[model samples]
Target: MSRIRATLVATAAAAAALLAPLAAAPAASAHGWITSPESRQGFCAEGATSFDCGEIKYEPQSVEAPKGSTKCSGGSSYTILDDNSKPWPRTTTGTTVTFQWKLTAAHSTASWEYFLDGVLYRTFDGGNKQPPSNVSQTIEGLPTGDHTMLVRWNIADTANAFYSCVDLHVVAGGTDPGDGGTTTPPVTTSPTDPTTPTSPGTCSAAAWSSSSVYLGGDQASYNGQIYRANWWTQGDTPSNTAWGPWTLVGSC
Candidate 1:
């Protein structure tokens, strides 16, 4: 098993040498984070059947975080920045990660970049940013015992290079690579009562409101989950009072 793992690591290093970067730890609120004027992710998405950004692509992209929607469905594509963005699980040495990425349109040339301690390490930027390049880079030089591998995206050209797809595979110490293998643990879900009820009794069509509800960015509780659409209260008929001002459920 160790031998297999060793071989896998070597192969991954080689492939990553050929390819190129990109998690999150969620808490009650967004706090203490590494912010950068320049921030990005190398998404490792293999392809689109599902909306998965495998990892952050070093290439430029338009993949922004969602505004207000269930799942990572719709919103402007976000540029990578650690400025109190969604928290990600810690990264460390001997961790083998793998994923895919895509760009809106490739320029002539691009580069590979590595960040150490929340700073830019090396950039493989060439003459232009046009190539639909596949990249992979390993984080060498670990300081003693443990550290977090915070990776983001950087474009040869922000104007020309726009990202489309990505995904990631990273595990501390060692493990087979795939999209941050540790995601929300497998759940055997059953319907539970709402901690706070919108209606006095049961939620009903009659309880629905149509007041123009403004879904604010600050009200976003889940990293990429939308509360507006889900558990929305509609009006009896399209009246001015019922016309709308719908607030997201459970989020004042």
Candidate 2:
């Protein structure tokens, strides 16, 4: 073969090899964010806030970056999340709050971390396995006040982690945010009644019925525990675990 023909073929092969990776490179595999207690991204995605949210409103699950970032954006391109100047709506809650996450592409997770205004407060073992599409974790003994929380979902096999920020206005005896701004009414009792409980927390809530429709903050007693509905639900049994729409408030 002629030298020029051989040289031309070799150059073409090299160019193709260089361009192949650029054409076929895959995007990073990461997804998920706290939805309940409505994270900043969650509020944006739901159109619950009036401020401009940029692309994050459309892709709430993509705030991913290296695992070490403390920023709400996780150092990703969604920097609008880090802006405190925006009037971000805060979830009002009691000392105990339940956080729920929605996963589009679940990964083998290493751990889940919760930070309150940049301080690590709680963590859950991910078991280094894929998680369900809907996952919930409740944090007990949370300090009451207005605060920002940063949540991290660490991938087991990758250096990337998903980050979300949630604003909370925790007040004493406050109900969960989804409860539509009303506090549970105090149970009434007569002084002549000998069977009435002395404490409100110990008072028996209305018994949960399978045929009844309940809305957010609606309380009922189920299996000796007091449970509150996170949202409109019917026939879902109240549970203390992270799997159901009912949140176990305390023992009746």
Shift in Å, residue 167, candidate 2:
0.4
User: What does the lDDT come to for candidate 1?
Assistant: 0.30
Write down the TM-score for model 1.
Answer: 0.30
Separately for all candidates shown, the number of backbone clashes (residues 3 or more apart, or on different chains) is 71, 0
lDDT of 2 by residue, 85-117 (tens): 999999888887777776767799999999999
Would you list the C-alpha lDDT of every candidate in the order shown?
A: 0.30, 0.77
Q: Which stretches of candidate 1 lie over 4 Å from their true place?
A: 1-60, 63-86, 90-100, 127-129, 144-252
Assess the local accuracy of residue 13 in candidate 1 as a C-alpha lDDT between 0 and 100.
91
Among all candidates shown, the one with the greatest lDDT: 2
lDDT of 1 by residue, 175-232 (tens): 3232332221111111222222243332222232345322111122222222322111
Residue pairs whose backbone atoms clash in candidate 2: none
Per-model TM-score on C-alpha atoms: 0.30, 0.65
